[model samples]
Target chain A: MATIETTGLTKSFGDVHAVEDLDLTVEEGEIFGFLGPNGAGKSTTINLLLDFIRPTSGNIEVLGIDAQERPAAVRRRVGVLPEGFGFDDPLLGREYLEWAIETKEADDDPDELIDLVGLTGDADRLAADYSTGMQQRLAFAMALAGDPDLLILDEPSTGLDPNGIQNMREIVREQAERGTTVFFSSHHLAEVEAVCDRVGVMNEGELVAVDTIEGLRESAGGPATIQLECATPPTELGVADLDVVTDVAVDERTLSVTCTGASAKVDVVTHVAERAEIVDILSESVSLEALFNDLTDGGRDGDDADSEQAATEVAQ
Target chain B: MSVRTVAKQDFLSARRSRALWFATTLFALLAVLIAYGSQGYRLSATEQVQNTFRSFGMVLAVLLPIVALVASYMSIAGERESGGIKFLLSFPNTRRDVFLGKLASRLAVVAAGLTFIFLAATAVAVARHGAFPVGVVLGTYLVSLLYGSVFVAVAVALSSAVGARSRAIGAAVGSYFVLIVLYLVPTIRITALVQWVHDTMLGMEPNPHLYDAVTYTSPYIAFRKALNLVLPTEMQQEVFRGSLEAGGELPVYLTDEFSLVVFAVWLTVPLVVGYVRFEGSDLE
Candidate 1:
């Protein structure tokens, strides 16, 4: 079953369309990464899903329940960690978690959840006194209190050290293993690449692509590059005849073949080994960071042109 | 249950605010001082208690609204500013829960403070004079509570209407000045000026009934008139004899029941407006 689904969702703040014609779906028990730049409408989409804001048009469903019609029911089963969230009260971390537990009507131990988020010693201190990283950890613990069926974390790793980020990744993996649907938004491409089963890249209020990391890499442009070091240079290797090999370059005894997919790597290796002895081979796949930049930068130029045209029309 | 939970949280935060504690203490001290000072005068017990009620009513007419504004001006606006509303709404609670919870909690704080001061004043009055009128004291306290609630509702409504903390603070203070100071002060001055002009220049008497109706538009004045009905009949005559003599009788519209209804309107209208505005907003 889909944990979250939205169809043609649109939200506009006057002339600025914050989210436009968004269609999305997240299956149960999958870690779906929502990636976008600062103003690409990631938060707006999440807000619509949580029913924090009413949509200008379209429908949203969470756990098969219409979110707009029954937000409280959806909220009861979903945990959210909103961006820029702060504790204005002088409540201790443990007390805040306990409040969240009561709010969710769950029996989870606050102390245990605090420890899980690496906020053990800081649980008794006032949350107002916590540093940004500590506050993030405490909020994560609160979100984990109810054993929720769905988790929506917006920029959950905004303020965290490397060790804290590692702990967050482990917790996300653990939750996904427990069949909890995890939908999170982040600018940290590497983190999303590590844990996300599927990723949706949004730009200018629209989703550009949604696919697995490897698939996104392929869609961005060519696949993995295989670098082979051979014992003898194969002068008679006509690799240009194969469709999988986009390009092949030979530098002394080293052969570099760019394949369209993982399957092409073996074919190239076999063809090279038939002519020359293969010593070592190295494959380098495209990083999500590079693919994300490629996709968003392209989208940004288009957005700039559209806005410029709008500005000209207004002037006229 | 959600409303209670939100209210409890707000109450706990209010308890931690040093400003609220300071306001409550100052009000209590002032009440005690007034109660003790009245005892020095050589008068009957009824006169002493009536004096106490009159003096306390005057002080609370100014003091309670300020305290109520201070207690509630930041209730929703501060949460919205600090991005805490995001965390709160992410839970199972609705926006209506938050609005009602904040109103209930602020009302509780103001009521508790007023109750403390009234009780202290009663103790002082009982210790100085041999007897105290339970009916008048309770009546004054209840009416004062209702008056404070008007300002509390106004402050919370303004807080919800504005998006930022600074704007909410400005709105609350601005409304306070308009309703309490500007509205009441100018009405008195203008009425006196008009009456003087009519008598001296036109050689005619201004209608006292018209004067009472115009002045009674101020909630503070309406509250005072309502308190007059609760006091002893002799005290009512003492306070209102000039107006009664001028008009030959009080107008039907200027009755105690009408003032009570005015106070009720002051309480209900702002609260309903704030609730509806809060419900309609995007909360971002």
Candidate 2:
């Protein structure tokens, strides 16, 4: 079942269309990463799903309920850590967590949540005195109140050190393991690749791509590069003619071939072995960071084209 | 449930603030000063009690609204400006709940402060004069609470309507001047000036109803009229005669009942306007 779904979702502020014709879905129990550059409408889409801003046109459903029509019902089952959220400074961190527990009517012990977020020592201190990272941890713990079925985290890893990031990743994994659907947006490509089961890439208010990490690499034409160390360098090997081999280059004693997928690696090896005695082979795959940059760079070009058209219209 | 939770949070947070403490202390000090300070006049027991109530009421006409405004102006705008309202709204609470909850919590604080002031003044009055007018004191306290609520509602309404904290504070202060100071001080002078212009320049009879209308618009004057209902008839006539022609009766619209209605309207109008605007605007 889809935990979240949006159809033709759009939001505009006067002349600026912040989000346009966006359709997305996050299934139950999957860690879905919402990836985008700054101002790519990632936050806007989250706000729309949460009904913080009314959509110009679209339908949004969270936990199988129309969020705009029944936002309270949707909010009850979902815990959200909104981007740029501020804490009530005078309240102690423990007080904040207890309030969250009360507001959500959750039976979870606040102490356990404090421990989960590694804020046990500072929980009794005023939130105003907490460091940025400590505040983020407190917000994360609050988001876990009620053991919500869905967690919507926007920029959840922001203001965290490396250790905090690792702790956050572990909590997300644990939540997903407990059958909670996690929908998080972040600019941290590496972290998203580490935790998200499926990723959606949004660009310029449009969802340009959605797939598994490996699937995204494949769609970007980033194939695995395989290097073969041969007993004898073979000449005139038509590895390029093979369907799986995207490109092949021969260096003195080693032949390198790029293959489109995992299965293609086998075919390339077989084809190379037939020509030369294969002693050893090494393979490397492209990273999600490269794929994200590739996708957004392409998105930027589309934006440039759109602005050029707009400029010409103004001139006319 | 959500409204109550929001209100509880607001009340707890405000209870920890320094401003509430300062306001309460100031009100207590002023109450004692007004009751005991007037003992030097050597007036009778009834005169002493009436004088103390009038002096406290006059001070409250300026002081209580400032206290209420100080306590409440940041209630909604500060949260919205800091992005805390985003987390708040992420809960099951509606926008209307947030507005009402804030108003309700601040009202509790103001009511508590007013009660303390009233008790302090009453104690001083009884100890200094050997007597206290329970009916007048209670009535004055009730009217003062209503008057202070008008300012509290205005401050909260302005806070909710604006996004920036600095802007909200500016508006709240500006509104304090317009409602408490400008309406009370200038209406009397402006009314006199207009009457003079009509009598001298326009060669016409100055309209009496105009003066009544302008004066009653001031919440301070409305509170005074309401307090008159419980005072002795001699004192009531004495207070009115000072402000009106010696032989003329008070205007119909300036009746105690009408003043109460006006106070009620002052409390509701700003709050409703703020709630409606708050409900319609985006939280961002």
Candidate 3:
């Protein structure tokens, strides 16, 4: 079942198109990442679907109900960790969790979530006294209070430390494995790429691409950057054909080339070794940092224009 | 969904807030002072009810507005600021469910606490002087809450309009003062401290016409006038007044026609306005 389906969902604040004719379908029981740069309208999109703000035009169906028309009904089935709500006050951590549990009416044992979030020891301490990482853990516990079928987590890993980030990844991945559909949005693409099975990249209020995790990487140009180390220079190199060596920069004895295809990385590395002395072997995988910069920068004008057209159509 | 649960949550939330507890407690203690601290009245059981009614009436006529302000000031604003409302709103409950549930619970707490203090004042009166007239004591406190209905609406509307907690509180408090101290200044101009300004403003010739208009135009004075009608200090006279007179008629000093309309306006206008604002606002 589709938990969320929006057709041409558009929102504008005077001249600024915050979210433009965004059409998306979120299948039940899958972790979906709404990947975008800052101000790409991830938060705005969530707010519209939650009915905190009405859409300028188009339709939003969340949890099988029209969001604008039946927000209370949709809210009943959803759980959200909103962005910028990253702060809390003097309430005790465990007590806050208990209140959330009672409010959401989720059947999970509080003690179990306490352990799951690893806050059993500091359960009585005031939440204001918690470190940023500890607070993130508490927020996670709050999101899980109701055993919600669809969880909308915005920047869930914002203040987490290194280990906390790893723990968050595990928790998110675990929820997805347990058949909960997770719709997460973040400016930090690394967080999205780590746990999200599929991703939709947006730029300037428009969704440029939506595909399986592997598919987005493939479509965005597959990763290939080779590092080599050799004992001695050999003869006869540069025989294998490489796809688009866009740029080749050299630092001391190592050469770095912007190329597509990882298999081509092996070909380049073998050839480099036959030509000169090589030191070490490394393949710079196309991390989401690289992915986002390219998409937002390269696709900004095209994405914005495309989205404005869609928005006008929805308005009509 | 249960009213009991709603009340319990409200009570707990208030208990968790030490500042709110102190502010409300101070108001209750002040009500007692208003009754006991007056000059030369016989401190008897019946007089105690009359005194408490007078003091609570005056205090709550003002304090009820404050309560209404605090209640609405925090209603949606508090939730949005703390992110607590969003968490609760995401539940199966509708906006109406959350609004009424929290409101009922908060009201129950305030009412319960006020009733206890009013009852204490009555007990003191009986122990010191004579038998208690249950009707007068109960009526004063109950009506005070009712008169405060507009304050609640105004506060709630402001809360729904903006997201800043401190700004919301300031606006509600400031607006209350405007209605009381500014527009109704001539009526409240009785204190010795303000006599100099009063002399300058009135020049020994206070205009009866201006004062009457100001009184009705001011929600605060109008509310006090409403209370004076419902519970007069003349009850301390203890005459064998007719039952119909005791239950319904206004005191000789208060004209019932205008105050009743003001009270009704306070109850309805703000609620309708606030609900409309709430329906349009972004939950963020």
In angstroms, give how far residue A150 of model 2 lies from its true place: 0.6
Position B141, candidate 2: lDDT: 85
Measured against the true structure, the TM-scores of the candidates, in listed sequence, are: 0.90, 0.91, 0.80
Fraction of true inter-chain Cα contacts (below 8 Å) kept per model? 0.68, 0.66, 0.42
lDDT of 2 at A1: 65
Each model's lDDT: 0.83, 0.83, 0.67
- Interface root mean square deviation per prediction: 1.0, 1.1, 3.1
Tens-digit lDDT string for candidate 2 (A1-316): 6999999998999989899999899999999999988889999998888877899998999999998888888888999888888876579999888888999998999899999999878888998788889989999998899999999999998999999999999999999999999999998888898899999999888898999987876666446677888888856788899988888888987888877765688898888788789898886666676567667763454466653342222100
What does candidate 3's lDDT look like per residue over A44-118, in tens digits?
898887877788899999888988777767765677776656334456777767766776666778788878877
lDDT of 2 at A39: 89
* Chain A agreement with the truth for model 3, given as TM-score: 0.78
lDDT at B39, model 1? 51
Cα RMSD (Å) per model? 5.8, 5.4, 8.2
Cα lDDT, model 1, residue A221:
59
Order the numbered candidates by DockQ, best leading: 2, 1, 3
**Model 1: what is its DockQ?**
0.67
As for candidate 1, its clashing pairs are none
Error of 1 at A267 (Å): 5.6
User: DockQ, in order, for the candidates?
Assistant: 0.67, 0.68, 0.31
